[model samples]
Target: MKNPKLITKPFAQNGQKNAIPENYSSSMESNQATWDQGFGPITMIPVAAGGLPPKGQDFNGIFNQISESVVYLSMGGRFKFSADYAAAINGYPKGAILQSDDEKKEYQSIIDNNKVNFNTATQAQINAAWKLFSTDDMLQQLAGKQPAGNYLKLGDYGIGGEFPPEVIDANNVKLGGIYAPAGAAGINFYDPYAPMFVMNRNGMYIRQFQITATGKIAARDIKGEWKVYSDDEELKTRFLGINSTAVSAKQLSTKSTIAGQEFYGKGETITITPQGIGAQPVGNYLKLGDYGIGSAFPPIVADADTLGVCGFFAAAGAGSKNYFDSYTPVLVMNRDNNYRCSLQINVNGRVATRHRSGAWITYPTLDEFNAKKSLGEGQRWQDVKGSRSSGVSYTNTTGRTIALSVSTAGAIASSSIQIFVDNVLCSRNEVGGGEGTNFTRHCIGYAVIPTGSTYKVEASSIGLWAELR
Candidate 1:
């Protein structure tokens, strides 16, 4: 081979290895033998002592950059996208993942060079270009499963026939007011063969109209032409009839009428004819024309219209006062019918009369009354005594007659005592004492002192007196 040489290394390789060797001989043939000694010793090339060669340094920087990209890719890192970032590139590459500027969503490019603008693109364009991986995408998937059409509207005409009264959207459920949806017009129930509705519990049946085979027809009221039967035989039923038209009296089984008049249903015509005054009594009770007798209707006689009678007295004006009779005790009352007083006889044969204020006083016996009258009006006596110096004095506030007696004691002659009533001298007396001998003397006597009067006794010399006031 002409100019053949051994090439060992390529340019700008990596790592810290020394430079590779290259040998070339001018015009060297393929089969020519080269001297073994002529061959140069295998020597290492000179290398930079402390660092890589210039080419290696350049290559190492490139490798470091490449390693960072690989680490990011292996860790599933996505591209950070912003408004400014999109303007720099036509599209993200396939397999590239990126987040929107707001960071609310992440998208992966579905095709090579997906060029759709996530923010500005239409929903269809974005979906074609990207596969969203956020919560919003999950919600979209769920939304696809909902009913196809929009929610129903209310108040539209022609409902319940071909067109339905649509169920209003939940947002507008209260649009028609408090009882909305149900309050919507033209709502119909498809009840053809069964009862319109039924209300019942598992064991207890409530109330419902029409018929039901499963639940019993238990209700508080039954109207119209309802009838009760046992074993297909009609039972006797008593009911109050209320009708707009009169029922014939001939159709009724009982002919007896109350108050001489026929009773009819509400809103019916009635004719009342006064019966002739009958002598025969109605049952055991007396009728209008029958004579009243016996205890139930005792005869009231007006001739014995006095107390202590053994029967009732019929007085013309005292009809409401009371039935005055011998057996009945009288309860005296005022004109207003309030209890005024009462007279009663005790077991001791004493007559005790009660006053309106509830005080009861008995009438005195004849002997007691006579004795009190003989005694006449009485006087109350209160003793009034004093020494010779003070004498005695009294003022009468008792509002009754009072009596006073005067006495005097002295040791000298001409010793005297005097009594006065209302400042007027009523009595005077003088006593004699001989040779220093003490003696006592009496006044004229007692004097009556009227009300609002003052009684006084004055003594001359040493004296003593007594008074009854």
Candidate 2:
């Protein structure tokens, strides 16, 4: 047995070899040389049982070694690869690490081994840990502080609500802010610069109101209690001034007088006189005792105002002689044309006079003969008989021309009548009539009278009458 300790078995393939074996060292060295020629040099480094690779080694190996050390330290001591643990190692005052399902075994091992203290932790510690592990940008966010100019501070209160304010002078009196009292309503903060208080008990605060200056309700400089109501309502008695009442047309009286003249009365009468006598009646005939001195009346004397027969005679006979004297000579006649005139009558109602001669004179009617006979006796006589007679008579002739109308009362052999004017046949009518029959005729003639001519008419029938034109 030559140096069995020096001759080692083949290195296991599980990477547990710390150093090359003596038997294979030569061959391994030659292979390494060939590999170096073909690829690169392979440096052989010694490792303790639990030590990592040294610095300046291959990065892959160095990383693996550092990872092992980290895992081992996390398992074997209070220090770990956790964020809080790393933060603590890097001089952060507080740090923490979060647990994961994959790293639970290692984390639990570290806890069980009393390598890490997880029980003595808080949100602050976790936050510190996040700050330590995160980048500078993330760390800044983890600080939980806002940048400048990012927020506002609570200011003062305003009229409707809260608002900002400022202190201007030393007294520290707030300026440019308004605070309204509870339930106090108005045009609040009426002037912000000059604050005022308006306490309206009825909650009515008009900024401005107008009052007529000429109103009877006097406004004084003194202030006192007042009651305000809607203008549409009747004013209360207490608010009404002296001598005030509701006005209406019915309240006034029409019987009132003005300027000493009576305005209203029943049945007024007025009397006027130039002489100023109240008892003097109009249309009175003034006598000597009726008027006073210096009173005047009309100068003319009317016939109705004459006093005596002389006054009547003066009014009637002022312009001519007496009427009786002018008629005295007519009572006496000197000459008479007929003293004992002989009268003769004709068949046609005419009278004639003869003067002892065999000459015959004819008067148109008896009224002419009677007038001549009265003149012979020197007597004034008036022929007054005014009618016609069947017998001839020496009297006044009353005459009328009667128009004849022929109409038959019954049937006859001949129903005819003939009309004549001045004894000459003028018209004829042969009527054939029974009931309701009628005819008409017209004629003109003359009659004699004492002083004036009279007209005469003759008719054959009694129903005939005459119309004078």
Q: What residue runs in model 1 are displaced by over 4 Å at the alpha carbon? A: 1-380, 386-393, 410-413, 436-444, 461-469
TM-score against truth, every candidate: 0.22, 0.14
| Top-TM-score structure, candidate number | 1
Q: How accurate is candidate 2 locally (lDDT)?
A: 0.31
lDDT of 2 at 347: 39
Question: Per-residue CA lDDT of candidate 1, range 1-469, in tens?
Answer: 5733423333323554332113335554322223322222221223443321234443444444445555555565555544344444655678777776455688887887566656444467788988886744667778788957754345333222343234332222222212122323313212112222223344243222322243333221112121222321121112222112233343244453434235535444444333333456767654442322223443443322132322222333334332323232333333332445545454455566554435556787774564344211553332233211334565665444556665554344556777788889887777555676565444344577776688777776433344342
Report the lDDT tens digits of candidate 2 across residue range 1-469.
5522331222232343233222333444332322123212233333444333422323333344445555544454333334334443453232233333222322222121122222223334433333323233554665657664633235423334444232222122222233332222322222223332222223333221112223212111112222223342233222323234332222123453322223444434322222322344778563552322123431222221221111111212233232222111111111243332333233354545444323445544554544445322433222111212112222212222122232223343335444444444555555444455464432222222333233233333323322221
Find the 10 residues in a row with the least total lDDT in model 1. Answer: 231-240
Model 1 residue 386 CA deviation in Å: 5.7
Candidates in order have lDDT scores of 0.44, 0.31
- TM-score (C-alpha, index-matched) for candidate 2: 0.14
Candidate 1, lDDT over the whole model = 0.44
Question: In the order shown, what is each candidate's alpha-carbon RMSD?
Answer: 52.9, 72.4
